[model samples]
Target: MTVVGFRSSIGTWGCAIGLIGLTLCWPAITPVSPAVALADEPAAAETPPDQPENDGSTETDSQETPSTGRTLEDAPTLERQVLTELESAPHWPARALAAIRLERFDCAPTRDRLIEFVQHDPDWRVRANAIRSLAERSIEQGEGWFEEEAEPRVIRTALRYGYEVDAGRVHRGVRFLLRSNRLDERLLGAEIAAASGKDDLVADATDTVRSVILRMDRAQAGLLSPRLSAMTGVRGLFSRQDWMRWFRENGRRVELAETRRDPPNPHPPPAGERSFLAELNVDAFARFESYVQQWPELRIDLVFALDCTGSMTPVFSRTQSIISDTMLFLQDITESPRFGLVAFRDVDQEFVTRPFRLTQDAEEIMLQTWLQEAVHGGRQSESVLAALHDSYAMSWREHVERLVILIGDGPPHRGEGGACIRLAERARTRGGIRTQVVEPINAPVRDFKEIAEAGGGRLWTLDDYVLILAELLGLERSDDIDQAFMAFIRHYTELLR
Candidate 1:
């Protein structure tokens, strides 16, 4: 598939290659411009020959920078070179690449430059990259960016990175995207609503989805129906009147369901107490049951590969609960769904990878115990490749659907020779194991996305995982899954490719 187009001529692949080349050539490049050196040469004439050239920023001034203590002049040579590219690169792709590279550096100048690109870059791709860089640094511009940004791609980038959303901005952005003539943009609007997890916008988002489905042809509507199902949390409602009637009767219940699961709810009930499917009114529940009854009984084997490292400590409990809830929900829907788990940390840890074979034990006592016993003290980068490789050793069922959901926050350590990606490819080709990633918004996502793509699955954020899973598992036929995948690729081309 082609990369999504920005307002520039250069394709994404070309930009990626150019950026890689620039990184490789960084060390040999001159750090300072000759003009700046010439201007400072007279003042520094009295300095020792071995002394570094001073850029005139005081030490006190450096202390006040955002995250890093060094000014651009004192920053490492590689960072300085990337900063120069960001400032003076002629092409939009070069600037975009520079913005992405700058994410690793957290100094005042880098922050200022990224903010400038977010505000004034001519190309949307550059702005999107800059937005992601800022988000990675934990620098949030709040709802103001959402209110001011005109491009859906830019807004979606912010949304995907955990930017705080309020009622006012969501209402405005949802209305703008939903009202667009382009089907992709409209679908993105529904996506934005779903990602936002704002119960208040449910009515408007549901109404818009219903209206769009009614107007589009069957094929196009087939692509959009999942969004409606995701938003309303009820499947099998086809006609506009059916959706309207359901919403009128149970709209408040949908909002309440969202409230229960939304991340902001500090006191979320335990996994056993919450069930989105069970909470639906009797009629909606009956409809969903009827919808699933047509499908032939199928056997499925699932595995969860979780990263138990220091970085994941903050959200570990919540993540575990979500996975537990997911298992319960899947059990409710499917006839036979067996689950396994592989908890992993870095090589330096006591254990690199701990595996639990697939089992039909619905009690899930062993899985839950392992999940709770999983320790979290490794380095930032975990043994993801080891976990993936070990997952293949599981006794997967033959001629049945197999899935592996990798939940993590960091990439694999260096010098793994891309073994993790190769495992993903082999899983799809020989083992029939589809891989999906559930990643935190602030985590480095490119590698996880690659694994998912190789294993023929989609990468989902924690906030959107439930909805995406609902859509993915609810599909009755292969063609419907293909259409859903196409819609996903269309909306997320910038991130996926």
Candidate 2:
């Protein structure tokens, strides 16, 4: 389909603060000339409430519009302007807005650029918008183009994006995606089931997807809250168990021959609310805190975000040693303390991020196994943003103080004005995941400091970070672990000095 006319306007878009940027892009089509419209000109069409932009605030205010007074007026110009912004825009909001606006532009290059964004953009918002935009455009343009031009990966990405855009057209896609054993794909299916707002459809989800829904963290719980909340008149439900029970009891309602005609609820619960999930979480956490204060011990959910890049090779063995010892210490001192790990390297590497589920492995063997087996080889910068995003997603037990200790030697890609900092803020404000950065004596410290502060965590040298964690957990430093930590502190201090 060739577009004869279109208009671009800087409009307000929803920027999700903490969760991987998930924004809805709906471009308003207005007939206009092939000339670029200046910012001062009034927009012909009203902007959709879900326009994607990066403002770093967790609040989803519909009234928030882009500061760019300009709008797109033609396909050729839109393609040029959007592509230019995606390539060179200094700020994420510009890139994201470019991506959201790209949806309405119809051209072969636009399609290709959207696919590129899906594959390569470091920022998740750009990639998501590109996927959603491509899916919407393909649906509108007809099957001929997709049948002839779309690749398998593109089709799969489109199917997932279709769930967010138009679920009605992607039933077969959802079913196909559900059959995949990959956790990410299954997650796509589960999200589709929840987004569909049809309980029978959700109930029919494969066991894998069902299990995922049953295992969702509070953030994931928030995703399924809209229809569930509206259905039960219960606004504050959290945890996979509560949702599973509700689904099992109400699954039959969605199976009726008559389709439910409930108006879509605009406000799906936000994950960052002070009363996240249930009132029970608040009460339980309050009691847990009181109990902890009385007991004089720390109950923490600790995750290690280790940098496993080529530059970090020198410390790989030592890092593993540190993790093994720390886990053992936690097991002995804290009451069933949970431990998790995220090992990361830069983009275009063997892997960007490798995440392990939270566990209390008393043996402390498997944690060591992963630490030893994972190789780090790539560019100097790494996927710190990806690691932070995964850290936010971990299912920390309720009432446990969530802490992520990021141990890395390289700066995060897109460190300046990137989504990583905002995401860190999101993790702190929404998920209550405090982060601490442990920079290698040789690694860049400025980025680590900024990101750690943004996430409400601290930045320290490797040795100091280890000691701080130990002290907080009330672990005695009189042991071999403490000696090893102290030795490193002296070595780094002397070496750096």
Candidate 3:
């Protein structure tokens, strides 16, 4: 088995090709004067370097002036350059730059181009940037675009725009969005309501959010709960009852003091490194009849298709810890586990699918190191179908149980729904490969249930990952086998620290 060591720098650079900054920001729209564009000089002062955020602040006396002194004396020339870049940029990165620059103009042509970008930009980042651009122009114009836009990024950008520019507009738009049956839209509305501190919006949408959470299965809960907590600033509210109690007790008092330019982190920083014994906090008392009965462990060929997107960075770290630290345990199972890993993110982010072939390497040192160096993903929605298809293509040993554990936070790209289920169905019936899903915290479990069911596998939550895997592998908590495993984890954590 040739396990090559390789890495790609897809999302780490900011000079021109990759993401401008690790922090998410609205790229400012600066109009370059014809004099500046034509002359041997730098661009205008309005053109700030592509920083992730812009805090609506002007340069004070202490701030330095632009090296180039070309002023916006002629609107027509600046407008022409913006239009030219929007239409003629050779690459998507260049196109994204133009889209960001397009945010400054208020003319009809500018508005039309933004709309076009929102509708047709193949790159979601560019489209999202366009949405922000359109929103910054005017709330009325943004609301108009919202009527025609359905992408989650566009809707999210519009909501933030309303929160940034006009609260009443946010309330109206959220009200309309919450009325929809679309889960993503409703969730966006709920988050905005919680963030905006609009009592009326909260009163109207809390019930809906609660209902959705209540209807979700365990895997779905694991993924959606953390997001709700972050958006509402409610901690540890994982159950439906918890949400109801919070609303009844403090919903009215929930007044957002100001628009949060940066939303709080979903995965809060840990308090401190726990004692090695803490790693053995397995749910021994909890029963695992469903997982054990439906999908017992066997000699298996496994593929872990993971979401390596930006939002998943926290979970990704945890995942790396679990996989790398438990290599000995994974190898010691009655049916030795041969693992193939696929690290995936959305299109236009970094590399889409970085695959590692099936191996039972005792250390998995290379995989561990590669995980450390993986670039952060750019967008939220990932290429689920692509990852699953790649997983299904891996070579499997004869007479072994074949499994693919697909994990991620958000749903698949638009128009690619049910594609995974279809593939899983075929793989199960014809190829004997069962596809499971380990929905990471805050991941939406929309079609993952269907995918698991189609492959005759149980859908799992990241919260129950350890317990379920232990049970499947016939490893008991606190047993010699388990202790040895925890010891390895302890050593791994200490070394990393």
Query: Candidate 3's C-alpha lDDT?
Result: 0.51
- Candidate 1 lDDT tens digits, 246-353: 657864334311311212212222222322321233343333333333223546788888888777766665566456545644553355778888888877777888
Model 1 clashing residue pairs (backbone): none
In angstroms, give how far residue 389 of model 3 lies from its true place: 0.6
Better of 1 and 2 by TM-score: 1
User: Candidate 3: misplaced stretches above 4 Å?
Assistant: 1-298, 365-380, 474-497
For model 1, the superposed segments whose C-alpha errors exceed 4 Å read 1-291, 294-296, 365-378, 471-497
Which residue pairs clash in candidate 2? 7-72, 8-71, 8-72, 9-71, 12-65, 13-51, 39-69, 39-70
- Work out how many backbone clashes candidate 2 has: 8
Winning model by TM-score = 1
- Please list all clashing residue pairs in model 3, or write none if there are none: 25-52, 223-442, 223-443, 409-443
Which should have the higher lDDT, number 1 or number 2? 1
User: Candidate 2 — which residues are off by over 4 angstroms?
Assistant: 1-297, 362-378, 415-417, 474-497
Query: Candidate 3 on 100-148: residue-level lDDT in tens?
Result: 4454443455556666776567655466666555444431332223333
Per-model lDDT: 0.55, 0.49, 0.51
TM-score of each: 0.38, 0.36, 0.37
